[model samples]
Target chain A: MKAKIYIKYKEGILDPQGKTVHNALESMDIKDISCVTIGKYIEMDFDNISKESAELITEDSCKKLLANPNTESYTFEIVD
Target chain B: MKAKIYIKYKEGILDPQGKTVHNALESMDIKDISCVTIGKYIEMDFDNISKESAELITEDSCKKLLANPNTESYTFEIVD
Candidate 1:
């Protein structure tokens, strides 16, 4: 199975990298760009695990290590 | 319009961060995980631009600033 997880800072949090990206776009004459938020995309491959177990592990990873739930939100998808 | 860009290191490249995460997972007893790779997910919002223009700008951004074409590749999707 393969799993993908995306993690992003919560709204209203100050995202310095996003702000920098926005500014860079403006400098490049991309004035129509309004917002730029950067996040993490994690891809994982699993073997010898059932889909249900993969899902549980992913959820646990997100909560325990992949994201700081208080400030970051995460979503994941699993595929065979 | 909203655009999503995913940038990742090319295959065969060493991803230190990913390795660290793998080790962490192993330490936590998540041994079924075989491989892990981490990348950047960038989301941008645009106003007053046609879809074609948004696509062009996103491509340019990936080439010029968002990714190093030598070792990184990027893909994007735009939505109205």
Candidate 2:
């Protein structure tokens, strides 16, 4: 089985990198570009695991390894 | 309309944050967790834009504002 995890910064957090990119875009004459936020993606492939097992593994992964849970949020989908 | 953008680290890039999380997981007695990589998600909502126009806007937003296009890659989908 395979799972894809996406993690990103919280909406209200200050993202300096994103701000820099937004400024660069304005300098490049791109109009109406409001904002940008950055985060992470992880793809995991496991063998010999049932769907329920994968869900448990993924939940643990998110809590312990994948997301900070303080400043970031994560979502994942299992693939057949 | 709304667009969801996902950006992530390249496969080969070294993610120290991910590694740190992995190590923490190990210390917490979680096994079989091989590796972790992190990335970002950006959701944008725009008013008064056609789908084609949104595509163009998004492509330009990605190139100039949304993605670095060097160490990161991005994908965006338009929502009704």
Using lDDT, give the best candidate's number: 1
Best by TM-score: 1
Lowest lDDT 10-mer window, candidate 1 chain B?
B57-66
Pairs that collide, model 2: A39-B39, A39-B40, A40-B38, A40-B39, A40-B40, A41-B38, A41-B39
* Runs off by more than 4 Å, candidate 2: B9-20, B64-71
Supply candidate 1's per-residue lDDT for B30.
74
Candidate 1 residues B1-80, lDDT tens each? 99888888999999999999999998988778999999998998888899998998888888888889889888999988
lDDT of 1 by residue, A41-65 (tens): 8999999889999999899888889
lDDT of 2 at A27: 85
Q: What C-alpha lDDT values do all the predictions have? A: 0.90, 0.73
Global Cα RMSD, each model: 1.2, 2.9
Clashing pairs in 1: none
CAPRI-style docking class of model 2 based on DockQ? acceptable
